[model samples]
Target: MFEKVLIANRGEIALRIHRACREMGIHTVAVHSTADADAMHVRLADESVCIGPPSARDSYLNIPAILSAATITGADAIHPGIGFMAENAQFAEMVEEHGFTFIGPTPEHIRIMGDKVTAKRTVQSLGMPCVPGSDGPLDTVEDALATAKRIGYPVLIKAAAGGGGKGMKVALGPEQLREAYQLARGEARGAFGNDQVYMEKYLAKPRHIEIQVLADTHGNAVHFGERDCSVQRRHQKVVEEGPSPALNAEQRAHIGGIAANVVRELGYRGVGTIEFLFEDGQFYFIEMNTRLQVEHTVTEMITGIDLVREQIRVAAGAPLGYGQDAIRFQGHSIECRINAEHPDTFMPSPGRIDGYHAPGGLGVRVDSALYDGYRIPPHYDSLIAKLVVHGASRNECLMRLRRALEEFVIGGVETSLPLHRRIISEPDFINGSYDIHWLEHLLGLKG
Candidate 1:
């Protein structure tokens, strides 16, 4: 076990890693930007160091500064809590070269899976069902046209190295393809530094389901089941829940096994998620997230497994404590990503937090990095916290989440609480009959 570990990111994820380290008797060193000197994670950690300025390029995402902080603090391992350097394959290699453990998948796996084109090919090799589309990166409009022709109409163009719903465009016919192609390519290049785009058949009204998987260096892998993340705006997830209300028994097992098979084949380590789009009762692989996801707490709540501790233990060369059969998903769990924003228009609202009050009660768990006086930072993601609730059924879980959100209050900044209140009461959402397009349609109706 490592005596100390350095957290390489900020916000609630950083605090989550710090708490996990403390419970495991490991000292934690927090690296923060000049603007984050007084952040919650910095104050809670055992040691702290200022890495760089407020800009992400000079701060949270700066490799040299973080490495120096780890060296100065004598941390043998580094936990890239989320975002920024979490999925940087080259950075993972650098950490290893500096004799510090990167608490995630191997650099080889990260490099292979980070690129959506390469990831799809890898999964295709395993005989998994992938969306009918191009096998590699599409470089030009001509290449995209050919691929779209092969896949049929209503094609989707997406960034090869994209996540969080960025850099995506759909063209319903050939006439619209050229404009959508350039737009998606431009967005992809701006976001991932690679203009590589891929085309796929756009399945209508699909439910987004992802399986949570964990693997050890000892060749052991198991899945904790799936989460329904169809609730979203602009392709980013807002609300998520476990044991999707749409999945039948056989389909659940099949999807879970399909995800687990990929983990074993790729030799993936630590906590990861395999996302798939399910439409008309058929499933198609999308991509895999190479690090811990924001909705990880929902999986933990149902499975009673500390995913962070398991991630650390795997990095330390420890074997998995349980196998496939030993794992079980109990009850339904729901997570609402509470962000500081205008729920109606979904705009960012970062400012001082006054009269803050978080939801509390049985079955209510809030994963946040906030306080009564904490000022929400404008330089990063506007997400302030994740509110997760567990219950025996989906109805019970929704009720708990509704109550929790009602009890939640944060002044001085607009939040999505009112939006959630409306959604939770919507008849379609309550009946679990909504799809990925449902949220967007609701927005259009209000407009």
Candidate 2:
């Protein structure tokens, strides 16, 4: 067992990992940027090192600094918590080469799944259903037109790297395809430093469902069920839930098997998610996130499993604690991302929090990186906190969530709490028949 593990990220996830390490009796070395000097993770960890300045580029994302911290602290492993160097393949390889456990999948798995094009192809080879699209990178307008004709309209042109809805465009015709292709390519190149763009048949009113899969080096794999991430704005998921209200028992079982099959076939390890777009009763693979997702808490809330701890155990070559048949899922879980942004205008709102009181009592969990007087840093993600609630049933969960949101008293900066309140009250959302455009449609911002 590793005596000490270096954490290569910050904020709520970092603290979450620290708590898990404390339980496992593993010492933690936290790396923080200058701006995060007073961060909770720093104070909680066994040891901490200031990597660099306020900017993430000079600090949290600095490879050498993080590696140096791990070496100096005598950490046997490095755990990248959802950001910074989490999915960087080169960094993963470097850590292993330096005799430190990466605490995730192999570098080959990360590299293959990091690129959208390669990931789609690999999943397709594993016999997973994917949305019809281009075969590979399209260089010319002519190349795009040929692919679009085969794919049919309307199609989505997306960057072959990165998510969060950046470098993506939807086109309905040849002229629009040619025009949008260059723009998407340029955006992809600028955003991810890779101009590789691919195509997919765009689904209208599709539900975003993802299955959580965990695999061990011993070839044991099982799924924890699915999360409904249909509540999104600007292509980024704002809210998520486990045991999707829309899924039937049979459908859930089918999808869960598909996710486990992919992991076993790919020789992947650790916790990963297989995201899919469901339209009309058909499921199409979107992409696989090779790291723990922001919505992982919802799954944990439903399944009673600590995914982060499981990742560490997997890296240690431990066999899965539970077998496929032993894994049971119950109840319904929901998570609302409380970002420091205006509910309507969606602009960043960063400042010191005034009154910071979270809802408690029963079935409510709030994961946040804030406290009284903790400055909401303007340099990073605007997400101030996460509100998760679970219930005996979906309806009961919604009722509890609505009440919990009412009790949360966050002051100083604007938040998405009101937005969450509005969503739970809406008839469409409550019906669980919502699609990707549900949020924008509810807000009257159809783009």
Candidate 3:
């Protein structure tokens, strides 16, 4: 086991890793920007290092500063908690070259899965299903048009290195293809510095489902199960739940088995997520997240597994002591990503929280680092907390989620609490009949 691990990120996720390390008797080194000197994780970590100034490029993404911090603190491993440098393949290689464990998948796997087009090809070669589209990135408008025509109308142009809905555009017909392709490439260049884009058939009402898998160096791999993340806006997940109301036990087992087998075959290590788009009882591989997902709380709630602890143990060369049969799926679980933003307008709301109170009860958990006077830095993500709830049944989980949302209160800045409350009360959400476009449609963002 590592004596100390440096967390190379910020916000609640950094705190999440810190708590996990603390429970395992591992000290933590929290790296933060100047703006986050007073962050909660920094305060609780055994040691804290100021990596750089407020901008993420200078601080959270500053690889040399982070490596220096780990060296100075004598950290045996570094945990890149979601976003920033979490899925950077070069960063993973650098960590290993510097003689510290990167507590995630191997750099080889990260590199293969970081690019969407390459990931799709690799997984499809492994016999996984994929949406019909171009074999690789389109080199020009003519190439995009050819691929789009082959895939039929309403093709989705996506960036090879894109995420969070950036570098994505949809064209309903040939008339719209040129503009959409150029726009997607432009966005891709701006966001990822790589204008390479690919094409895929756009499913109008697919549900976003992802399977969580964990593997070890001992050739053991197991999947916890799937998360229903269909509730989204602008390609970002909002509400996530386990035991998707759309899938049955057989369907869940089938997908979970496929995910585990893929990891085992790829020699993948630590935690990863295989995301898919489900429609008409078929699953199409969308992309894979090579790091711990923000919605991992819902999977943990349903499976009763400490994923962070498992991730660390795997990085430390510990074998998964069990297999798929030993793993058991329990009750339904739901997680609402409460961002520091307006519910209606959906604008960033960063400021000092005047008053804060988290909901407490059976089956309810709040993962947040916010306090009354802790000023939320405007430079970082707006996600302030995660409200996860579990129950014996989906119905009961819905009821519990409602009560928990009502109890949550944060003053001096707006939040998405009201939006979550409204979503829970909607017929589509309550019945679990909502699709990826449900939330946008409900908000009148889509026609």
Candidate 4:
């Protein structure tokens, strides 16, 4: 086991890693910007270092500053708690070159899976089904047009290097292809420094299902199961649950096996997520997240497996302690990402937290870094916490989630709590009949 691990991110996830490290008897080093000197993770870590100013470029995203902190603190490993440099292949390589373990997948896997186009090709070659689209990047408008004609109308133009729903556009037909192409290219270039785009058949109202896989250096890989993350806005996940109500036991086993196989084939280490778009009983590979996901908590709740501990153990050259059959998936778990934003407008709400109290009781867990007097800075994501609940069943889980949300309270800043309450009470949501477009449509009705 590593003597010390440096966490290279901020917010609740940083705290999440800290708690995990503490439980494993590993010392933690928290690297923070000036804006987060008093952040919860900073306060909880065994040691702390100020990286840079408030701006991400000079702070959280600054590679040199983070490496310096880890080196000076004698951190043998660095755990990137999602976002920032979590999926950066270059950053992972840099960490390894500096004689520090990057507690995630290998840099080779990250590089291969970081590009959407390359990821699709690799998965397809590995016998996983992929959406019908261009064989590779569409170098010309004619290539896109031809591919669209073959795949049928309503195709999506997605950036080869895109993420977080950026650098993407949907074209209903040839008339809209040109505009979508140009816009996606510009956005992709500006955001990822790569304008290359690819086309694929866009399924209407497909559910976003992702399988969580864990592999160790000893050549053992297994999957915990799938997470239903269809409840999203602007392509960002909000509400996530496990053992998707949409899939049966057979379907779950099939997809989970495929995800596990992919990890094994790649000789991947640590935790990763293989995302797919499911429609009409068919699963099409979308992309792979080469690092731990925000919804990993839901998977942990159902499996009773500490994913973070497993991640650390694997990085320390340990074999997986359990096999696929030994893993048990019990009950249903749900997580609601609570962000400091206007309930209706969804604008960022960054200010002092006057009154704060997280809900408690059975199966309720609040992963947050908020306190009564802490002021939220506008320099980063507005997400303040994650309220995760588990129950014996999906229905029970939803009910518990509702009660937890009602019990939770935060003052001096608007939160999405009211919106969440309204969502959980909706008939469609209650029945688990919602898809990716469900939340947007619900928001439109309110508008």
Clashes of each: 0, 0, 0, 0
In model 4, which regions exceed 4 Å deviation?
Answer: 445-447
Best by lDDT: 3
Model 1, 1-447: lDDT tens digits are 999999999988999999999999999999998878878999999999998888999998889898999898999999997889999999999999999999999999998889899999998898778999987888888988888988899999999988876789999887789999999989988988988889999997899999999999888888999999998887889889888989987898898898888898878899899999999998899988899999999899898899999999999999998888898888999999889999887789999888888888888999888888888878999988889999988889998988998899889899998988888899998998888888889878423
- Give me the runs in candidate 2 sitting further than 4 Å from their true place: none
Alpha-carbon TM-score of each model against the true structure: 0.98, 0.98, 0.99, 0.99
Q: Candidate 4, overall lDDT?
A: 0.93
As a whole number from 0 to 100, the lDDT of residue 361 in candidate 2 is 72
Residues 63-173 of candidate 2 have per-residue lDDT tens digits of: 989899998999999999897788899999999999999988999999998899999999999888999998887777788889889878998999999688888999989
- Ranked by lDDT, the better of candidates 2 and 4 is 4
Candidate 4 collision pairs: none
**Rank list by TM-score:** 3, 4, 2, 1
Q: Rank the candidates by lDDT, best first.
A: 3, 4, 2, 1
lDDT of 3 at 65: 100
RMSD of each: 1.3, 1.0, 0.8, 1.1
